[model samples]
Target: MMNPESLRTVSVMRYILPLREGGSLPALAEADDDFKYVLKFRGAGHGVKALIAELLGGEIARFLGLPVPELVFATLDEAFGRTEADEEIQDLLQFSQGLNLGLHYLSGAITYDAAVNDCEATLASKIVWLDAFITNVDRTFRNTNLLVWHKELWLIDHGAAFYFHHSWNNWENSAKTPFALIKDHVLLAKASKLDEVHSEFTQKLNPDVLRKIVNLIPEEWLQWEDGSLKPDEIKEVYFQFLSTRLTNAELFLKQAQDARKTLI
Candidate 1:
């Protein structure tokens, strides 16, 4: 059993995780003896690529008042070194006491049923579209991108974000997803479901929460190798997108308002 409390920082994560292997961000992490405080950092993000993408990307999703995991910036000093647990840190991270979105490890509960989880579909689609615009490629199905907690689906795992290449001006390849929100996606089916749960979900997220998330990104975390980027510029664009994304939210509200018309 290795003592994570004796470590000084994750420095970097290195392991051949066989869970989700495809696209760019291949899942890779090792487990430690630490009971529940596991830290995860993207491979490329460790050296470059504005690590803020993970923090603020979740913020953007939350700002839309959609179902997203509870995320925060967690630092593991060298005191928190590797444990002698299994082979992957993903499992350790799952049991982490950090800001989690109540994700429970279930063997057969996760599925692709549409009607049962339409709201998740809609939100996931919109996230895919928004991420596409920002060039994020971490919300696909392979990574167990979405998790169900207490019967509510929450989005997670956003390491791959803002990957725009001058050589190619199109979205990169991705895995199969139920709902596709490319461009101006209309989440009609899921929007209808949100009509009843808007108050419950929207109350957890707002503009202020979104702003707070941006403040959490460590300055050094945003440094890149090729050069530096104006994260501030991207932040502003995020706000603008927030303004428009709400329209998609309004569609969900329209669903709720319509439901009020019925007797049941």
Candidate 2:
């Protein structure tokens, strides 16, 4: 696993095309390293906090033995926005002139379709456990956000996870809150042995690992509406939330198991 502190920074060399699949309106761009990356703009409508979720979620997933595309900090130049004739994209690039998030593009990767592929129950359980842990409500059948590259499943587009950060006014109060929405998770039906998966992953993801992953989020992206918390203070909240969830995983585990039983 690449140390979160050593996340590579790349410079955008060329603006390739726009990917209109998600609400963020991420675009394809070639970086100075001669690699194509799906660039997530900090200036997107979702704001910088979404980028923080992506960074934190991707790193956490990677640390937990899940396959995620390589993440890089891509530096954008305002001139690239001027080259874009589309006014919306031009404005997007204009505001995202500095640091942004990039996912190393997976060439020829196909969207995961449950109808065509059979996923292992254990791995599906692990993924479900992860979504429950992070409170990710985006991974429904309507939007899998999963890719099949080289015959292996790769997780992508985690900007919707870690959503509690959006409202930190009651942050501490929500630390151990149950994620009731996991029932809608795309992999819920295929998930089995979730209790065992929870035990194993909770042990694997200790406070140290959570701290490292939280630290990976750039301090700039840690801002909120009213600036109630400093960067370091907000970062600590992330660790506290994850730790509290892991310590209280039973609530969600049972919820998932119950949901599975209903389906069965």
Candidate 3:
């Protein structure tokens, strides 16, 4: 695993690319590599908590063994002196303009739907639920936040996570929020196949790794009316949700194993 601390040394340029309709990641080309990596610029004036959340979230996602892309934390340097009037508007694009490397935009040899749905049912379910439990704000149908690499689904774009801790701890009025309407969405229904797949793995989460992740967050990152949340709370909540998911997953798997029932 790449050390999370190394992200601070990534040399990012200031050239802004056009913002996609859905995500905050600025399009960026990795230095000297033919391939491009999506660059997410930290808001010019973000707090330590937000920064911590961004870094730790990526680290934890990888440690959890999810199909995430390799994350690199980079910075704006002199080669990045060029900027549009809105410095923050797509400021990460210049890094990708064939700097000896050709134009390599986001593309896959295959499409996301090509991944064998039945075979990856568990993987699909865990990632989606992890996002929901984390209250990740991206990954909607329009943005999906996934990439097809080696004919497998690889996750990308995490700048929108931890939105819950920042914006919704006391959000009792979930009905008023956009999330309330998704309870019975088709996506959720389809997720059942994944739920069944995931049930087997919930109890398998590496507790030691999870403990390290929760503790690694600089206490300031967790926010609530009273202040930041205790690390135990975060772990506990995650554990409970994942455990429930495991139970549900087992039932689904049992049904799938039985020839009479089809995988959802």
Cα RMSD to the true fold for all candidates: 10.2, 1.5, 7.9
Checking candidate 3 for backbone clashes, the offending pairs are 14-80, 15-91, 16-90, 16-91, 17-90, 29-96, 196-249, 199-246
lDDT of 2 by residue, 182-211 (tens): 989988999987978887888788888888
Residue 139 error, candidate 1, Å? 4.3
Question: Which segments of model 2 are wrong by more than 4 Å?
Answer: 1-5, 223-225
Give the per-residue lDDT of model 1 (tens digit) for 1-264: 111111123222334343443323333333332212212443322322334455555555665655654443343334232552553443343333222111112333364344445555455445444454344544433343565666877655455554442221322222112112222222333333343445444455455554555555544543334544565644544444443343245443443335333512
On the 0 to 100 scale, the lDDT of residue 131 in model 2 is 91
Cα lDDT listed for each candidate: 0.40, 0.86, 0.45
**Candidate 1: which stretches are off by over 4 Å?**
1-39, 42-50, 79-144, 165-212, 228-264
Which is the better candidate, 1 or 3, if ranked by TM-score? 3
Candidate number that wins on lDDT, 1 or 3: 3
Q: How much is 65 displaced in model 3, in angstroms? A: 2.5
lDDT of 3 by residue, 14-56 (tens): 3335435433344444543333555544432333334444555
> lDDT for model 3, on a 0 to 1 scale?
0.45
lDDT of 2: 0.86
